[model samples]
Target: MIIDFFSAGFDVFSSPLALILTFTGIIVGLVVGAMPGLGPLMGIILLLPVAIGLPAVAAMGFLIAIFVGGSCGGSISAILLRIPGTPLAAATLYDGYPLAQKGRASDAIGIAITSSAIGGLIGGIVLVFALPS
Candidate 1:
């Protein structure tokens, strides 16, 4: 049953428009999230009108991509500027800023992004495998 759902999702995402909108949403979210005071929620709010016009699957993919990208984007500012682009990024500023101060801004940003990706992947895996009965 879950496999069927997964297969259906793959079929839906095979659409070019869905792929394009998802990538665009990620880019837009990254830009918006990098700015201090703008988080993933803000990114979603800003792009809600655009999402509203999209088809159901495409809109969902776009919004989810935006959230994923935005979640990672905040660390860019947190590391480089010692400022949290979002509240969730506040913790990043601690170690990330120190690394940046030590002349490893790129490394810090890389680590931040990699960690965020790993965390997201683990969380996603957990969500998928641990669905409620």
Candidate 2:
């Protein structure tokens, strides 16, 4: 059963269209999320109509990418401008602002991206393994 799940996931991700849409969604989400008053929910909602026209697997991939991108995007503004782009990024302003003041904005952004990726990976793994138990 676990193997089947992995196989299905791989198959879905192997689609070129899915990959392209996911990347585009991520870019769009990042842009939207970096703007104040916008967040992942809004980003996803805005793209919902486009997703509705896509295949199930591709749509899921695209939406998930948007969600992940948006979650991280807010930190960009928080770090660079000392303004929280989203409510979720408010906490980041503490360290992010300090880092930016020190001329380490790039470092802060890198750290944010890396941490987000790691956290997402762990979450995905946990969800996958926990689902069967």
Candidate 3:
């Protein structure tokens, strides 16, 4: 029963439509997060009406992807422009700007991306374990 439950969850996420929607959400989140005065809340709120029409699982996946992308996107501006695109990224400027000044901007961005992926994996694991069956 537990195996079946896990497999069913994986099947939903592996679907073509879910993948497409997740990608779209991530792009939208990244764009919003990279812009000054824009953030995930605004992005999600703006798209909430559209998300409402989707299936429950897809809607959750889409919104969650947006959140993940937005969280990571702020680092882009911080590293390249020395300006934190969102408040969440403000601390990133400390290291990101210094790296950019040293002509290692690519390295900074790469580290940020890698860190985000690790964090996302951890978050996913926690979510899976924490959710009530």
TM-scores of all candidate predictions against the true structure: 0.93, 0.94, 0.88
Per-residue lDDT for 1-133 in model 1, tens only? 8999899989989899999999998887788778998889999998899999999999999999999889888888988898888887889999999999999999988888788889999998999999975
Model 1 residue 50 CA deviation (Å) reads: 0.7
The residue-by-residue lDDT of candidate 2 on 1-133, one tens digit each, is 7798689889878899999998988898788878888988899998999999999989998998888889889999999998888887899999988999999999998998899889999998888778854
Cα RMSD for candidates in order: 1.2, 1.2, 1.8
The CA lDDT of each predicted structure is: 0.89, 0.89, 0.88
For model 2, state the Cα shift of residue 42 in Å: 0.7
The deviation in Å at residue 123 for candidate 2 is 0.9
- Model 3 lDDT per residue over 1-133, tens place: 7689889999978888888999999998888888878888888898999999998888988998888888888889998898887888898899999999999999998998899899889987999789887
Q: Over all chains combined, what TM-score does candidate 3 have? A: 0.88
Sort order, lDDT high to low: 1, 2, 3
Clashing pairs in 2: none
Regions of model 3 farther than 4 Å from truth: 130-133
Query: In model 1, which regions exceed 4 Å deviation?
Result: none
lDDT of 2 at 34: 88
